[model samples]
Target: MNTADMKSRHTGGSLRTGLPSTAFMLAATAYFLLPLWWLAVAASKSAGDLTTTPSLWFSDVHLAQNLQELWTRDDHIYVRWLLNSLLYAGGGAALGTLLAAMTGYALAKYDFPGRQAAFSVILASVLVPVTALTLPVFLMMSQLDLTDTYLAVLLPSLVSPFGVYLARIYSEASVPDELLEAARLDGAGEFRIFLTVSIRLIMPGLITIFLFQFAGIWNNFFLPLIMLSDQKLYPVTLGLNLWNSQVIHDPVLRTTVITGSAVSILPLVIAFLLLQRHWRSGLAAGSLKG
Candidate 1:
């Protein structure tokens, strides 16, 4: 059969009306993009223009000035918040990924006593809501004199039960037992085998774990909110919330808050786009192996 005829037959000779699919796709696009579009418009307007102008389009084109105000206003605390977010998220994600990878590799490739029990505990911890632990964590930090310190936030952020789970699954699929056995026969230590073989094979899964943890730590608010009393220690999420709350009294801050919100989303977008290739490859490899 001809290709066109076969396709038609496979489709049951239905009328070629793609209108529903097209409309659904357009609706989905608008649903996601409309808020972003409004934010762009809102960010560009000054105090008066925001109220006077239409929300979907540009008015005074004062986004540059608004960004300047965001930086210079309020003791330039916005800049400090941005830096603190980067430090907390970046450092936490990196350390968390490393520890998760090591733990997962050991769990997957090694035979030891209490291994299953240890993994069961880690998995159980994953089921516990972080919000449930916040008060307890804060109390412990207070007793240890760690509250209000950077360690209070970064230390807890480093633990990722989900990341370890993903790493274990990926390690089992990607790193074959024969390879480790051969490496051992060649006089390579367990750490050397993990470093040289297992790590390279599991790179995609590691990237996925890093992205998840990065987004989590970057957008974390509750931990920082309760653990930190000083404004200097607040992450961007908490700082922006503070700015948003005061908008009721000083409505002029509305513009500044919108501008900060717009700027804060850029790092996350860039990070995801940069690592998206690895993420796709990792998920694809996992699914295919399964």
Candidate 2:
């Protein structure tokens, strides 16, 4: 074939190959975004408009009014729920990430007798569903008189087998044995080396772990529902769900619930956007430096 005809045929073949994948990705994106779009539209409407108006289109804008009522109703209890969510998600993620980093580092670097066994246990634990373990965790917390308190939720969140797994993977991939030996030769203690050297190199992985744990804890429903009987101690997920259930008796709460759901996701979105750069730079910092 002539060069022009060959190039035209190649381009046509490429387009044909790309079309299905592109269509699938577009479908997937729309699937995820449609709910969010509906939420935004619903949150902007007044209580009366929620049922009256089209579900995906904005009606008379009562977003500001709805937000005001949401925060002010029941003596501003929604604010309390929001704060509780922030505390639980933020504290749990930070502490969980730290513990995961430390444990993962030890598992990856240390030559302890039971290291492999311990790692195996952690990996196996990851396969066990969280729902399956929830009852046992509740029983344990009840025995300790810690159920209905923040500790019931926070303590369990801190032990993330998945986070530990990610940390260990990153530590092994990023940290070099020679670097540890060099640091030791420089008279740096193990803890100091870990804090200064290993932590910096594995920061991307840690950030990933933190974001995952944060979102998980923020969205956690069943655990908090079982653990916290007091409304004051309830996270946003449980609190919103409580409000949602009450919408049958108090239809006005439907708009409020929708508004609350829209607001609750803001933190997760902001966090991912803020740390996205670090996420993208994973392994590069360690690979270059080590």
Candidate 3:
């Protein structure tokens, strides 16, 4: 065959090979997006329209009315839930990321006694299921008399072994030993060096860690379900579940629940949009070395 003919054949074969993978990707996308689309459509519907009208499409836009009901119901309890979720996720992620970075930096940079052992323990801890530790954690909280308080949830949320692992890998990949040595020679304290130099270098990784922890804490249902009894202290997930449970008796709450679920997703979407650039860079850098 002529050169052009040969090239065309190769291109045809490549396209054929990519078809299945492309199909799989499209299927996966639809699988995930369909639920979100349904939620948006459902939330926009009035209670009567929700059951009577088509599910995947919109009818009358009752979103504003539903949202107003959600906000004003029970003296505006949904707003409290939103604030509580923000506090739990935002504060927990930030503090957890900081602790993870410090621990990871020490592991990557310092050659301390039992460093390997400590890292091994952390790795092992990551493999332990969160569900497996729930009872023990509850007991610990009981011992400290912290259950039903914000601390009960916040304390556990602040520890992320996966975050530490990611931080250590990113530290090793991004932060140079020579940079640390140079900073030390210039008389910068260790903590100061970490704050000024190391933090900037590994920021993308920290963002990744923060995002992961934030999502985990935000979606956390069991922790708050077990820890909190007071409705005022409940996170959005627990609060929504409470509303859902009462939906059978109070049919009006059905619309409120759907609307609240739709609203609950907004914070996470906003967070991802805000940090996605840094988070993508972090993933790329971390994957390059580890």
| Model 1 lDDT per residue over 67-96, tens place | 999999879999999999999999999999
Estimate, for each residue in 1-290, the C-alpha lDDT of model 2 and write its tens digit.
89999999999999999999999999999999999999999999999998888999988999999999999989999999999999999999999999999999999999989999999999999999998889999999999999999899999999999889888888888889999999999999999999999999889989988988999999999899889999999999999999999999999999999999999999999999999889666535544433
What's each prediction's TM-score? Answer: 0.92, 0.96, 0.98
Which stretches of candidate 2 lie above 4 Å from their native place? 283-290
* Ordering by TM-score: 3, 2, 1
Per-residue C-alpha lDDT of model 3 across residues 92-170, encoded as one tens digit per residue: 9999999999999999999999999999999999999897888899999999999999999999999999999999998
Candidate 1's TM-score: 0.92
lDDT of each: 0.92, 0.93, 0.95
Cα displacement (Å) at residue 216, model 2: 0.5
Q: Give the better candidate number (1 or 3) by lDDT.
A: 3
Give the residue spans of candidate 1 off by over 4 A: 1-22
Query: lDDT for model 2, on a 0 to 1 scale?
Result: 0.93
Candidate 2 positional error at 96, Å = 0.4
Worst 10 residues of 1 by lDDT: 10-19
Alpha-carbon RMSD, candidate 1: 2.2
lDDT, residue 25, candidate 3? 99
What is the Å distance of residue 258 in model 2 from its true position?
A: 0.2
In candidate 2, position 135 carries an lDDT of 96
